[model samples]
Structures are given as structure tokens and as C-alpha cells.
Target chain A: SQQGEEDPQALSIQEGENATMNCSYKTSINNLQWYRQNSGRGLVHLILIRSNEREKHSGRLRVTLDTSKKSSSLLITASRAADTASYFCATVDRAGYSTLTFGKGTMLLVSP
Target chain B: EPEVTQTPSHQVTQMGQEVILRCVPISNHLYFYWYRQILGQKVEFLVSFYNNEISEKSEIFDDQFSVERPDGSNFTLKIRSTKLEDSAMYFCASSEALRETQYFGPGTRLLVL
Candidate 1:
């Protein structure tokens, strides 16, 4: 069973706009990580936010985690056509299990 | 800047045949994992390996699936008897330690007929 669920299954925006995707999980986690997948290719790790952290930034990527709400959000600012891809949120539970439980993912389409 | 690498980007096999999906994880990494994503579906965790043994696995990783680290760098996923439902993209990932961020490979698209 999937522990996390993402909102806005699909999003379309023009290039240079900001894209935001939200994910909610049901269990306590040690950390939450975001990844990007291009079409049928592999996933690229974007960023990871630990439970104690509220926000993190890596280049154009920003991730915010709200442990109280059991949710997190990924924001890609000034999106580009190259930024178009499926974004997934994976949670590593506090049980010390290294496996990541991924969400269904949100597909973002950036049109140039 | 090192990344995980997978071989045979695409593979096709008949049902009941055996297939081996190979991966070379980042050097110096200790934990390795396997994941699968069916077309139009979310990625699912298959198994995790550490210290040359299975650490954890999901129900989807039944007896048909097995993992091995033949040497120090290569991690492989072998399916004993492939099924049509097995057609999906298999991904291999590695991390420096438990609970750390995992680096993913390009993935192998397996198509079982």
C-alpha cells in the first residue's frame, strides 16, 4: 500500500511559471524526498527535507515539510520546458526502514 | 556527481523465461534497493539489500524475484519465471547509509509477453 498521495494528478503551465505540487502522507517519517522522472526514464533526486526541518532549497527547487500536518510540498520556480516531468514524493518512515514509499506522483507539463 | 547505472535499457522475454536486470550502484555506497514502475502507475518498492543480505521486501517481491551483489559494485535483480504482469520499468537505487537519499539508475524496461 502507498503511504503518500499527491494532489493535482496533472498540471499544465506555460514556461517561466511556477509549479507547485503537494503530497500528504499517513505515517510518521524521518525524511521526505522529492524526485523527478522524465517520460519513461529513471528518477532524479531533487531534494530531501528531514522531519526536523521546515524548508529546504536546492537551486530552483524548494521543498517544505509540515510534520504537524503530515504533508509536504515541492515548488519549482520559473519552470522551463525541460522541467516538464512527473514529480514524486517518497517518505522514509521512522521505523528505521530504508525503503521509500512513493506516491502516485503529479505530472507537470510546461509548455514553451 | 556519481550516479547509478543500469544495463539493457530495454528487454523483451516470453512468459516463464528467466531475465536478469543488472545495475552498477555508486561506488562507496552500502545500501542498495530495487523498485518497479508499471506503465501509467506509481513506482513501487520491490526490495532492499544491505551487508549482502535482504533487509526488507514488499509483497510484490515474491519468490519469483531475487537480488544479488556478485561483486562490490554490481547489484542484480533476477526473476525466476517472468509473467506478463512483470512488464514494467525496473529501477535500481543505492544510498550511502540507511535512511539517506537514494540515487537511482536509468532503469530497465522489461516487456514480458
Candidate 2:
């Protein structure tokens, strides 16, 4: 598996439902971040969780990181139709370059 | 809120032609990067620039590719000769610090024929 790989390549849910996506990495990282991409658009930073931090939240989005297992999960609560997009997990290498290694993203479709 | 901005949202060029994609990173950001995503594929990092020099670049950023910070606000990615495989969405991102959140611009779609 690559350094950053997201499982459940695609997901579908209804409005107000919760969507959870998981990401697993293979090496040490300075931090892990989540990004959202609408169809044919650019990426938007959602949240960042440092390797030493267990969990972090921003409004309806919650992100948890487990350095022990080298895995992270993003949970979007009360998902709205606007939340329908592809969610990607990117890891910042601990080498201090700040380059982002991204995963194969999970496409979430929230239907009204 | 400030955001990175890219020019010519879309571009099409001949395979052997040169293309220069331009970006204006957030004014106050210090670090800048370029990434690309082939349709339906994962986003891949191309290069990172700081202090008017390339800090690190991926293997994909080969001899044909070059980056320049011509002035204070503009960062440009120039491809001396493009290939069909070069067709992808190129994104420009900037951050305040090395480990900080990187804000991305609405990518520029390049199609090489």
C-alpha cells in the first residue's frame, strides 16, 4: 500500500447522515490533513491533525489521528448536499519539506 | 479571506509546444507548491518553492519542467516541451509556514493534443 491510501473508494448517503472516511499511512509524518474537492475543481483544505494530536474538529468536520497505527479518520456529521465531493487525505512528511502526499480519495455523494 | 489564484483556468496546446502556467499565491504566504492530478487519479506533488528557490521537487518534475518566482507575487511553472501525458489539472498552493495548512487555487486544466 502507498503511504496515504483511503478506503471505501466511494460512498453514498442522505442529507443529515454522517459520513466517515478512513486513511492509512505507512511512514512517520509531521501532520495529516484532509481536503475536499468538488467535481473538476481545486482542493480545499478541511482540517489538519498533527502527529502528536489525537483528534481535532472544525465545525461539522471531525478528524482523528492515531500515530501508533498510522491511520486517520474524518467524520462529517449532519452531511448536507453541499458536502457531496471527493475527500482526500494528505500527509506531510516529517522531513520538513512540507510537500503533501495525497491518497486516492473517497467520493461521497449526499443526495437530497 | 485571501486565496491562491491561477490564470487561464484552461489551456490547450500542441504536444511539442511550450506552455507557461501562472499563479499568484496569497500575498503574505512564504511557501509555494505545485501539484497535478490526471483525471480520475490521485493528486501528485510536483515541486515546492521558498525564498526564490526550489526547496524540493518530485521525480515527476524533470528537465522539461521548471519553476520561477519572477516577482514578489507571481509564481510560474513552465514546460519547455509538453507531452500528451502532461494533460492534467495543475494546482498552485501556498502556506504561511512549512508545516502549516496549504491553501489551493482553483486548478488550471491543461490539455495537450
C-alpha local distance difference test of each model:
0.95, 0.96
DockQ of all models, two decimals each: 0.94, 0.92
Give a tens-digit lDDT track for model 2, residues A2-111.
Answer: 97899789999999999999999998999999999999799999999998899999999999999999999999999999999999999998875899999999999999
Q: What are the per-residue Cα lDDT tens digits for candidate 2 across B16-95?
A: 99999999999999999999999999999999999999999999999999999998899999999999999999999999
Q: Write the per-residue lDDT of candidate 1 for residues A25-86, one digit (tens) a residue.
A: 99999999999999989999999899999999999998999999999999999999999999
TM-score of 2: 0.99
Q: Candidate 1, residues B53-88: lDDT per residue as tens digits? A: 999999999999999999988999999999999999
| Model 1 residue A61 distance off true place after TM-score fit, in angstroms | 1.3
Residue B87 displacement in candidate 2 (angstroms): 0.3
Per-candidate clashes come to: 0, 0
